[model samples]
Target: MNTQFVVGESSSSSPHLSCDVFLSFRGEDTRKTFTGHLYTQLCQVGVHTFIDDEELRKGDVISIELDKAIEQSRVSIVVLSKNYAFSSWCLDELVKILDCKQMLKQIVLPIFYDVDPSQVRKQTGSFGEALVKHKERSFGAERVEKWKAALTEAANLSGWHLRNVADGHESKFIKSIIKQVLQEVNQTPLDVAHYPIGLDSPIEDILLLMQSGCEHEVRMVGICGVGGIGKTTLAKAIYNRIFLQFGGCCCFLSDIRSKVEELGLVKLQEKLLHHILKTKDFEVDSVAEGVNLIKARLGSKKVLIVLDDVDHRSQLESLTRERSWFGSGSVIIITTRDEHLLYGLTTSEIYRAKLLNDNEAQQLFSCHAFSYFSPPQEYVELTQDIIKYSGGLPLALVTLGSHLQVRSVKEWRYEFKKLKAIPHGDIQKILKISFDGLDVNTQSVFLDIACAFHGCYEAEVIETLNACGFYSESAISTLVQRNLLQRDWPSLVMHHLVQEMGREIVRMESQDPGKRSRLFNPQEAIDVLQGHKGSENVQALVVERRALKGVKLTTKAFQKMINLRVLKIDNLYISGDVELLSKELRWLSWEGCPLKCIPSNFPVEKLVVLNMRESNIQEVGLDFQCCRSLKVLNLSDCKRLRSTPNFRGSRSLETLYLDNCSSLKKIHPSIGNLDSLITLSFSCCKKITDLPSSICQLKSLEFLDISSCSSLQTLPVDFGDMQSLRSLFA
Candidate 1:
């Protein structure tokens, strides 16, 4: 076994190794002085040492107890102080301990305090004179000879010499002893995860891949996965299992990707060299120098190195780039989120880590939340719900479980309800690392999908995002590869935890709605509007649910939103003085709009999209002066009377939806002048309609849906100019 334990290495319950160390000191010589301090230091470091407490026990049963103590302890610490040989009780204990050491292969450490080892070995000074006093006592000569032999053997063995090393600092001396003994007692590798469910199978698979079978060959293995998927934990376990066998020169370099930015490559290279070379003062001025030193010095030594969470190829180049960097039989293992970093490496193997399975996730979560595998009888159903929401991600499961562990059931219900809207902060912090690594444009697209278009069709989301200038096609692919986003058939599906992280990014913009980039909370929105706190910072405002309490606002409510772009206000009823919607607005989706017309004076100069579906509108807005940028205008389900507006100058309009407009009457003569029009929908518009001669001018229209227009009479004669039209619904 290695001298130091890694995290998560639990001790086996063996009776023979029950006591960690047995303390043997002469009571009259050093019991109250050096030995007492040593025993206290051992206890502080969590060693199970058997120190003889003279104040607690009587002299009658002392010998029997001392014999049992030495028998159970795995290590015997014999403090050979001056006058140590004077007591028959001490000599008897020493003989028994030395016999156990030979028979059981137990560890023995002797401390020669203020006394020479030669004196103890030859029995010449204080020890020899004490043996003469023992000769006149009732003890037999055979017993005295046996005591002399035990002392000679122990003093000859290499051990701590206090007079030569301590320099009058007894505390420091005691601490040094504790350090060595602590390592011997707890030699675990790493604090393995709290619940290592489904851990053995993956580690076994990695072990198979790591097997090179020949001492002349070197092996490099990669463990790849998304963030919080337990890649680091698995890598540590693998390193702990086989690291001790690799000539005792091993280094576990963790957080390579995350820490390199804070602790530069030069520092990391220095650490790798120092750890594997077993030197403290090794120095290199630059990363290149460090790299050279590592290659030159460690080339002939068989080393084991675990490079954890490597995001870039440069980190590999500096640490362990090629198999020739180390001696034969050396092993190099790397854990990373990007598998591309190991693409062209020589003699490489990859292990793809996956999220925990359902059973494993439940077990892992139970360990964190309830201190057991499975919840209490009363919390069974609730714990299962928590597991389903976690989607088998171990980080999410453990984080959520820990958060709800000490809370009452009622509190759990309340917190779980809140999580449906905003995720747990600790969970978001971990998942956000993947999100934070994206570029600005990709991050914007992710936030859009997370906030509004999560369940929307992929095509529609792409079209809308393209119109808003967010390049999402490649960004979506990147997200999918990172396991942050997934695509369902019609709509995109993001893990609930990942989606919550995206929302959290927007939430962090500002607590006040006016200063936020996006506003979704109903109360915050109402407070912003009623208090006239709206600012130009807001880009999107979505009222997902109806107004809990009706809010009152004025015309100035939205006058400050100079940079507002998107609005999806389907719910909250904000009634008061009408405000001129911001001219910078691009996408306005106000379903069930209460107004008949959005007042012509409300300039929509930069509007790219507009939807007032299911409103009480009668006439189209007469403001064509500043609407040259309009791309989409949907008046669907507007029951009131309406007539199509004449388009003499608003040429940028692309999509026109008049579906379910029950009272539509006339088509203006210039209705066909929309040269940039792409989609035209007149479905369910059961009003009088006749083809305008100018309709054939829409050469760019791709989709034309005129189905259920019961009153339509004749088609345009020269419609052959509509060559770009792909689908027709009539």
Candidate 2:
């Protein structure tokens, strides 16, 4: 009996080929029984095998097409029966097969169906009889030569010869072939390790760094490595260990790249101030002012600071200066990828992050993939194969293994084939392998959140996604499951890198560049707000583009935004139009806006904070009289301003920042009325002379930073009245 093979048909809509195995067999001999059984067995094992059943046109040369399919496949299976050599078309396919074997190094497996090895090799018995007719036909001798060579090669190669095997034994034979294929597939390079949970070498190294103590002026320790190599994790571990030991500590995980991209270094310095000083309203006018403040205030404290994901040397310079700027016990730990940055820092000590070994990679993969310390019994063989294929890379191993965790035997086989052939550098290949395992809707949700919405409110995302016709709570759940998106209390945050990848995918899905919605651009943001207006689901608006002229605002827009809390509009060209803002607004930034002055009737009392940095306003006007309830006022770079607004009567002003009002020479002595003031910053007011003798009236002040006021010499005699001040910069 001749063994027959059939090729699977695929849809044209999906251009990418998916099958791992392509089976080639002559149909006439075993179309109804043996070949059919073999195809079923292949599918049952999840082999994703393709066998052709559709008839080929007579005299149609399928050589080129078949060769292309063979190249696309990882392995090719040939079923040999007695009459297989009779067809000239089959002979031509065999010729291409030998070519594939030579050129592409394609894997080929031959199965003999109740045919003697001698008969196949010499074209004897039924094979010989079929060749005689070909010998009598056109080009018979040349055809015979090729057939004899193909049979010889098939006979000599390693293969299974079934002699009169019954249908009951077919499963055993198929299983044997599967075992061999899986064994070959399982030779992947993976690392496996066994150790107590939550204990690693990096932890010990961090402890040692901490114990070394900060005897030098500026003790800087840098932890450098690639992304996902556990740099942040290690930094967090260290921070947790030592946070209680220091008198003051702050960890900033801001994305330096995004911050520098959105607001220049000068603005980032202000942000750092807000974090370090423990106030949101603080700002610094320039890098020079920031550096001076750090030296004068944090200079003598035994502080512990962790700057995670530091990408630029300038960021480091602007943040931490000489050892003299910090007290003897202060420690600063920086995590980054650029060794050059570490070398450029004022400190000398550095540690290079290394990739995990095989044992560690396997353990990490197994924990994520199988949700245990080891692979389950049923998937042990396949898990070993997956680990090997991941090549000891923990990220790939965990990503792929997690994808294959719940799949069946056959599914694993199919996945193994596809994964083996994928290019190593294809991040999508790794991510998709995991993503495809998610339910279709969950995949959609992941892609949407990863692409369009990040650092967005959870309730808003759910509502927006649901309104857009994607109602998949399960998908959102799956995203959280896969660590693609995280739910932080009420908001959803995507890792910066994952969001970037998601946008890349979304960009790939669209051809029109203008249709791409940008979260950063001011005009694009306005369009988004307009599109979703009158809906209570909107929570935050980050505007980076300048608002257009004559843009009208109505109470309806503000009234509907009951949940809105943060309204950031930088580089806006404000007009004289009176706009009623939501009283519920907690954070507002109007940097680089060209407003001549704030609205006289603006409700400043309800505002918890206000930032008007880099605006063209020459004066704060008497509008400051109504801001009795304000807590933070940032006027860092309002260069056109010639005087400080009188805040001596404002009792609720807890934090005041006026870093770069260089033209202002005096502050109203009535500033002493702010007894509730806890933090005050005036780092770069070079023309300022003396602080109010009444400044000592601020008995609640906790931080007084006046580092770069070059023309000013002494503080008020009553400066000691700030008894609660734990931090001071001169």
Candidate 3:
């Protein structure tokens, strides 16, 4: 009889064991039959198995080496043949394997080969006879009783039964056994995040989506969001939680964008197939061949695959092009910045990653910065500053928090100042990848919004951008799809860090603020205008109220800015000829202006928006006669204004707001010429007495507000002809 313990390969210099499975069986009964075949097939599939190959005389106790192997193994397989219970060594191995299963939570699988499961469980037939003979010998009663109990407990476990398979299908049975062994072996969890705060809810939400669909159908899920928004982290957490449920037929192909660039799709496909199949023998020569192989091999087995950081549609086409490529109940997850990449996927659900809320952001930040759940009392205010600046992005919070760890309060303040001027380098690099992939025109449009149009109404910004020779509609759509921009109701919103990155790009264009393409800093703009350092490179300029308290612009201040298309000034003093402003201007917002009137020579033909609310102007200027492209005109709270300007030349005007122009007296008859007017508000224009008949000719007018016009007497005779008016605040 061949009775020996077979030990798998273990590196002598290594400190830990590498064995995945330990085999426990009678060496003589099925040594060259079922047990031997099982061990060989397990080895062929790259499983590090421990099998007894050495032949020796029968002994009552198993060797120490054999016991240690069972303890170190991740799983133990017991091949129970007719005479398996006859060997004392096999019974001792069973007791040790069961002890490990309880103490170490090792997986135990009992294979009832050529024997009924009930025979093993009840210790009947050969099992009972062997134990009775051992008891009759010098073996202790306690040892015999322990062997019998281990057999009963192991046989009760959920395991394979050879008798259940077809009559001549032992090969199929072995294959099924190997598949289960692999499932238990590869159930190791992945490292999700250092501080996985706020991860539970998202994971639960994704799980619900997974279960909401029919169990027999494959589902593709896309997690889309801007960079640093935690798409990959959420995907990883979901993968870790459910990977074992798929029976270890799972693969997480991380950083797929980078992997594709470094090693072609064929290599990635090979890695994916090798991971799920548990073998490295399959070779893919090309992407097409790999696709066919994946569809053919994995089509029958349910799998979980996560494609992280996918950037292109082609990546999806090559990796998970069709739902039929995967089996029923299979789930394919993809995380990407561009949501459009998921549009072609069928039977899919898209989950947009949301920014962390205040509580979650605090907890996540505190974990990385202070190594606690919240910040210390001494740094509460500073911590809030960091959280606000992070704008709820998890990546920003984590990276910035880690950067500020172990630093003094003063250092933290200084670092925050630097961060405001420039986003974190790593974060910027990641976000810039999406920006860098855009076409030249779209990039310019993005820069425009990042510089001057953020928080502005989407329609107004689009009009202004269009006036500046951009295809604003398509560009804005592209930006939204890329996660670089978001439409919040009527306005467009960009992440604080993304805006900083875009502005930083403009800042790097030239060392001098005058030479840069856009100027957002009030001081920088004041300095450029005051020093007469203006240049054609300056395309947009914004100056806030506090910075313009004592500053005044001269006639030549904007003469050299020939390409300037956007200009926003707040409560500023202008002591020069406004006619010298750039003719290319498309957007002009001058709040608290002290001028009596806009000079007739001032350029307004190309202007799309003219907002001078709360200004000191006494009259609506005739210069508006050239504003054929103007879409929005807001002159609210200009208390000294008397009447509306003639609208003969402003045929494209869509929104006109003269609300709170207290001294306004009458509506000009030329208002009938505005065929495109949609909104007209003269609320609180208390001095106006009557409405001109031409006002009734506004066929496109949908909103009209004349509330608090206390002096008005009556409506126009043809007022009911304004059929388009939906909302009227009389």
Error of 2 at 293 (Å): 63
Q: Tens digit of lDDT per residue, candidate 1, span 520-617?
A: 67777778877888888887776664563354455577878767777777634545444456665666777777677676665566666677888777
Order of models, best TM-score first: 3, 1, 2
Candidate order by lDDT, decreasing, is: 3, 1, 2
TM-score of each: 0.62, 0.35, 0.81
In model 2, how large is the Cα lDDT of residue 157?
Answer: 76
Where does candidate 2 stray beyond 4 Å? 1-494, 498-523, 526-536, 545-563, 621-629, 648-651
Model 1 lDDT-worst window of ten: 5-14
Predicted candidate 3 versus true structure: per-residue lDDT over 589-631, tens digit per residue: 9889888887677678899999999999887666556777989
Worst ten-residue run, lDDT, model 3?
Answer: 3-12
Best by TM-score: 3
lDDT of 2 at 412: 84
lDDT of 1 at 476: 79
Q: Cα-based RMSD of the predictions, in order? A: 11.9, 26.4, 8.6
lDDT for position 580 in model 2: 50
lDDT of 1 at 22: 94
Give residue 666's error in model 2 in angstroms.
3.1
